[model samples]
Target: MDMQSGTVEEALDKAAAVGVTAVVQVGCDLERSRWAAEVAGRHENVHATVALHPNEAPRIRREEGPGALDAALDEIAALAALPQVRGVGETGLDYFRTGADGIEAQTYSFRRHLRIAKEVGKALVIHDRDAHQDVLRVLREEGAPGTVVFHCFSGDAAMAEECAAAGYYMSFAGNVTFKSAQPLRDALAVAPLDLLLVETDAPFLTPAPYRGRPNAPYLIPVTLRAMAAVKGVDEDELATAVAANTARAFGCPPPR
Candidate 1:
C-alpha cells in the first residue's frame, strides 16, 4: 500500500497493518530517513523515501548553519543509493502555511529535490498547496526527470488540465470525497483516466464519514470509489487502471 507520512515509528507500524501486500514508508529527515531505510531493508513489505518537506524549510533557513542543506543532501544521497529506496520525494512548494523563510525556503528545497531526483532517476511525490503556478514553473525550469506524482492534488479543473498536459500523475486524496468537491470531481471526469492515481495521505485527510479519524491505506477505497464515480466507471476498472499507473510512476508493481 502506502507509507505513513509521519515522524513516529508507531504510526509507521500501524500503517503496515493495512490490508495491503506491502507498505512504503516516508522519512522526513536524516536520522529518520536512515531508520526508515533500515526498516525497509529488513521488512519485505516496507519501502521508504528520504524527503524534506517544504514545511521543514524554515528549520534549515533559520538555523545558524554552515552546512545544513549540505548535510541533509548528503544523508538523502546516501539513502537514495540504498537498494531498497524507491522514490525521491514528497517535496514541493507549500504557500498555504505561513512561517519564517516560507516560500523562498520552500523554493530552495523544491529546487534541490528536482536536481537530486534527476540525478538519481527516481520517481518523485510532489506536494503543492496554493503554489501550483510556481511548482510547475520550477519543475519545467529544472527539467525534472523520471515520474512525478502530484500527491494530494487539491487543484481544480484548470490546474488539473495543466498538470495532465504536463504528464504529471495526479493522486487524489480522501478530500476528493467531500460533497462540496464537485469541481474536483468534474476535473477528474475530464482528465485522462490512465494518468490518475489515488492515495489516503495517511494518517491524514481521512475520507468523509471517516474524517477526523487517523487515515491509512485501508481507507483508500473511499477515494477510489469517488474517483470511479467521477469517471462514470465501475470501481474495479478504475482500480485496475490506477494500479498500472501507480506501478509505472513509482516502480512498485503489484504482486502477480
Candidate 2:
C-alpha cells in the first residue's frame, strides 16, 4: 500500500506522457540525499533537493548522538554544492510529528539548512506542518535565501497573502483537490500566478477520486486542473505559469 507501483524510469515516462516532464527529487536523509543527487545527475529533467526531514533532526540527536545531526548537515551542505542539487530542504519545523522535546534540535537543523542554502546560492524548500508561524519566524531570523518554496503548502488565505508579500513560492500538492480542502482552495485563489507551483508529493496525497491510490507525477494534471478551477484561470494558462514558476523556484531550466 505504501510503495509506488513502478520503476523510476516508468514513472518518468508516464509523467512525460501526461505532460509532467520535469521533477525535483527530494531527499530527507543522508542516504536518500546522495541517491537523489545521483538520480538527478543521471536524468536531465530531474533535479534534487537534499535535507534532513524536520523529524529526522530530533531523532538523530536522540538516537544517534548530538554530533550525528551536524555531521549529517555537513554532508547535506556538500551535496547542495553539486550542480544537480538545486536546493537544500524539506527542512524546517514539523510540530505535528515532533513533540516539544524535539523543537530545539529541529530549529537548529532548520537554521543550518538555511545557512547551507544561502551559502550554496540555492533555493530553500520548506516542509512546514502545523508550525507555520515558527517557520516564518525562523526564516525571518535567519534571512531567507534568494528563493523559498513552501512545499505542499498547507497554509490558508491569510498565510498565502503573507507568503506572497514575501515573494515565497507556495507549491500545492494533490491534497488541494480534496473536497474538504476549501481553505487550501481559498489560499490558491489568492496566491499570485507567478508564485504558484504544483507537485505530486508522490506515494502520498493522491488527488480526489484517487485518494487511496499511490500518487505519482502522472497525476499532476489532476491537481493542476483543480488548482486552475480554484484560481479562476484557464487550465493551459495555469499550466504555463506553473511550469515557469517551478523553474524559477528551483533555479532550473524548463524541461524541453
Top lDDT: which candidate number? 2
Q: Residue 217 CA error for candidate 2 (Å)?
A: 0.1
Model 1 spans with C-alpha error above 4 angstroms: 1-19, 64-66
Q: CA lDDT, every prediction?
A: 0.76, 0.92
Quote the lDDT for 214 in model 2: 86
lDDT of 2 by residue, 130-222 (tens): 999999999999999999999999999999999999999999999999889999999999999999999888889999978998888989999
Compared with the true structure, model 2 gives a TM-score of 0.98
In candidate 2, which residue pairs get closer than 3 Å at backbone N, Cα or C atoms, i.e. clash? none
Q: Cα RMSD for candidate 1?
A: 3.1
- For each candidate, give its TM-score against the true structure: 0.88, 0.98
Clashes in predicted model 1: 2
Please report the candidate that would top TM-score against the real structure: 2
